[model samples]
Target chain A: MSSCKFINTPALLLDLEIVQRNARLMLDRCQKLGVQLRPHMKTHKTLECADIMTGGSRRCIVVSTLAEASFYADRGYDDILYAYPLPFDKVERCAQLSERLSLFHVLLDNSLALQQLKKRPLSHGKIWHTAGVELTGIYAHCGNTYGCKGEEQIKAVAQQTTAITLQFMEKLKAIGIQGPKSSIGSTPSCSHPVPEMAMLSEVHPGNYVFYDVQQSLIGSCKLEDVAVRVLTRVIGHYPHRNQLLVDCGWTALSLDGGGRLPTGYAIIEGHPELKLTSMTQEHGRVEPISGELDFSQFPLGSVLTFIPHHACATAAMHPVYYVHSKGKIVDTWKPTRGW
Target chain B: MSSCKFINTPALLLDLEIVQRNARLMLDRCQKLGVQLRPHMKTHKTLECADIMTGGSRRCIVVSTLAEASFYADRGYDDILYAYPLPFDKVERCAQLSERLSLFHVLLDNSLALQQLKKRPLSHGKIWHTAGVELTGIYAHCGNTYGCKGEEQIKAVAQQTTAITLQFMEKLKAIGIQGPKSSIGSTPSCSHPVPEMAMLSEVHPGNYVFYDVQQSLIGSCKLEDVAVRVLTRVIGHYPHRNQLLVDCGWTALSLDGGGRLPTGYAIIEGHPELKLTSMTQEHGRVEPISGELDFSQFPLGSVLTFIPHHACATAAMHPVYYVHSKGKIVDTWKPTRGW
Candidate 1:
């Protein structure tokens, strides 16, 4: 902290070491399993994290928004997949990206979207192959993995998703479609990858880059592996209400988990006794889980770090992430926002 | 829509006429009440909306964040009140602002905050005059008005808050403090203001510029007064699941109001029968509140307008708001985000 300048409260802090470790482990796991790791950029949309997650390849990334795709493509990254279903209004933008980039992909779950794509033809010798729709990949998000409890349940869901996806791919092959990739995603599934998943073409998981309390609870990562935190300071101590009001609120941490966590909205880092009971626009009310809150232990000016319930949701609330390592602020990463 | 170019989907659309009407009504109300309407910028942190709310006067405004204070201050706005309890981390910044601006106010609810403020002496001769902590005004938020169900409840809460605030001000005068000023705010209380509120020096009510479903439900304003909406397009039709996927998600509209509305997270404009049931990263699952959803009626690629649950929360999610009037694109307003 001595090396770092004055940091504004309610700031998003990213631990570089934890992030790098998370990224390296995921990349190594994917490489050993013989599956392409096209990491999703929805969680930490910053380029620094993307570079670490991609192992500096800067290719084969999945983005939830066109803004991210354009942002990455503008900075020498290619082979971007706008993983969302084809937004009809953005068809022209998609066509432009497909023409400009070496391999930009758009997805369609129905024939109407295919027709919408067909309405606009791509130049540069690109054609809508495979029955007027390029069967680039079959993407399935195993979102149900979020409901899992432990390693056994996570593995079970992962295996089930893999089996179902493989069966779908077999059906595609039976219909004489070949060479299209098959990818299934969700941080919980990818973190504890099943042996059967190795047969799939790729796996996309974004939240592992900055795992939060939600993922830790779902067996995706340990609590220590979660890299990001909202650094807030106590602003008020109300003994009558048995609460300590903090500067961090939904504006900083977001309301993603619906305050369902045992620790409420988020886990107060290193203080398992504290629970973030509720938040307004710019103020979070924190109270103890069981016993009385000793106000002296948490002086008004003292800082409290909160590990968020969902990293992706929390990260979206921040404009810039302060990267720190060895108790020193190293860098700042600005994430591209909006569609 | 014909006058505009291909507008982006999942876009925040601000009805310019409605905004102007809302602003004018609030301004007239405050003028008639004989109190200064110092609008809070937390709802729409944009220069355009600020100007409209202030009747083109950038002076006399309240903000929820320091970033907003700096943003407005940089653009020649004066008489700013950072209406948050002084955080220890921001004392120096507050001092600097006080020195730079003609009038910059910071609040304190505790003695420690006053000590922190005293430490940061402003370069300008701005003194901490009143017993070591300046009583700029007695500011209280009638947040309880949010729980009200109709105008009767709204007015009752407003009157009670006004009575309490006036009593506090009377106590201050009795203690020999003469000219500090008094103010209480919140959209609900300020909208249906009590006559006693006229005795106050100023009133700060934001969110009227773009009232949302929550405020309407709270009887602050009618649903027709909501001037902002998220413009999304139906992308997928899942008859088997009885759902239609829209391109808007929590990333666009935010997960506020806890999806407690009968229409779920947001009200589908002109389609009260439809409900925005749930959302993922980049998709919203739309299902009817009851009965089978007619698939053909909402064909893929058709645009859908969603009146948000909370305008402040939804407006914060957008990078830029598309302002429209008379079915034509009039202007765009980019809001300042993050603290």
Candidate 2:
């Protein structure tokens, strides 16, 4: 374990203890609801983090990109679901990957996509000859829930998403394909007390593992539950502009705003008066809300921690994360990036 | 390099012919102005692109982060400038890197930063006795020019930036330092003609290689001058909702808006009627401006190219670029990423 003082500024830091706790809480909640939990690997793309989330099962996981799907498949993850609508040009690559995994599934929300999938022969014209490509499940992402105002709004969006998935499933059955499991969820819908439906076979929620300011404002988690932060340094102070520039900028923390929170971009850990007013490519501009900023409180070279507004977006920008446990660096994890 | 047909979706595609043209034009413009061009490599962090930008000189370049400075310095880039206010914690690293190169310079924008550098002994306590960590130059980024409405506004900000830089140089000289160069620039200021100041030694413009919607609106370049585009595919269509979802999202194009253009997130290469309304993590939602979108025109798997609002942010998202020239793949460049 290395000291925090030795770590570089503008680095991603993960609280391993909090991450494991979040994983266990989600797992226990899903278990209590008698539903299968398929952790989305899109948020934290590290196999080590996935191992903890899945309890080393490596059986089921959801990925946002084929690059991620191939990464986990190469490492022997059996059941992988590319959670987004399949890119038609990559159907051949999907077929090749399905041959190695026990099951590989993709999402379809519209009829045009279903028609394209029907025409595309999986496994080089081995249609119906072998289990060339298994349509493991049908899935829908209730992405609109991100814009929902409250629990009622989130539930309404979830219902609409499920109805759309059911209608799409009937179309699949009309084409002589029968009995495909249905999956629909987003972090907000899954985290809330969703009504149990017999049609739902799985729930996939990625960002609950490292809740950010967006999730907190959506009532999924508290501010204290956020497990990841960008550790930065106070570089320059502009008293006239009432701004203090930090090393962390849009490049490190991303440009995602605080979902429903009144906070501008991100919240400084322990300094509630500070507001991240704006950011440039490589400079974060922070200003005080009311009183004058005491520059002496945060001298040059002092480390300041910032919880991101969106964990997934922020995590995608970083290549490595410094994992800390019990106030010390315990491990390091490298995430697979790019398509 | 691979064929365009075989290249992956959401890939960074760089037209080498256009890039070289942009490079040549900027170089010629700087040459005509009789100002040295220390091209900022923060836009394209690749040795191949750097080679062309410097005209194979590999003598001087500007980087936004120390990691970039190290990446280029390790590969034989001698005169490298870490073109941000130096973080006090990294003074030792800057000093160590300076020892290996003919010149390694750091930027200072405030008196406090200068004082810290004065107190910090660089390279094994050679402060009082030897020439320790060298200040490459005084630099001021006219970042406010990005918000300027016209030539008059941009000129005012440029003058203010020059004034601040000159003021900082006097502070350096007062501390027994002398003869350090001064630089001040942004794409808007560098692209336009400014009053010749003897104090200014060089101009650093990063985004001229890939003029984007922002640059075009800023009157720096035309839309035809954009060199990089995100090659994506139409994956789904929703006629009832009037949305055509593509594979490129915020992760690929970023969330930067056009600086002064009326366009939304990004501009479709050949489809001006279509507007990228919003983006999810892996899906871009496009809508028509007035009439219904011709879904038949863009069938499933049809590739669509998009010019991003900010090229630097978009380019940073991709790991490799498919370089094209003369209607064929010419080479591939892998960009260095991370802190």
Best by lDDT: 1
Model 1 chain A worst lDDT run, 10 consecutive residues: A126-135
> Please, what are the lDDT tens digits per residue for candidate 1 over residues B1-339?
554336888899988999999999999999999999999999989999999999998899999998999999999899999988888888777888888888888888888888887777777577643234667787888999989999999999989988998898789789898788888878998889889899999999998999999999999999999999898889899999999999899999999988889999999999999989899878999999999989999888888899999999999898999999988988999999988
Q: Write the residue-wise lDDT of candidate 1 on A190-259 in tens digits.
A: 9989889999999999999899998988999899999998999899999999999999989999999999
Instruction: Identify the runs in model 2 with alpha carbons over 4 angstroms from their true place.
Output: A109-135, A150-178, A258-261, B1-5, B110-136, B150-156, B159-178, B195-199, B258-261
lDDT of 1 at A312: 90
* Cα lDDT, model 1, residue B66: 89
Q: Residue A220 of candidate 1: its Cα lDDT?
A: 90
Give the alpha carbon lDDT tens digit for every residue of A146-191 in model 2.
Answer: 8876678777887777778788878988988876677777888877
Please report, in order, the local distance difference test score of every candidate based on alpha carbons. Answer: 0.89, 0.79
Clashes of each: 0, 0
* Each prediction's TM-score versus the true structure: 0.98, 0.92
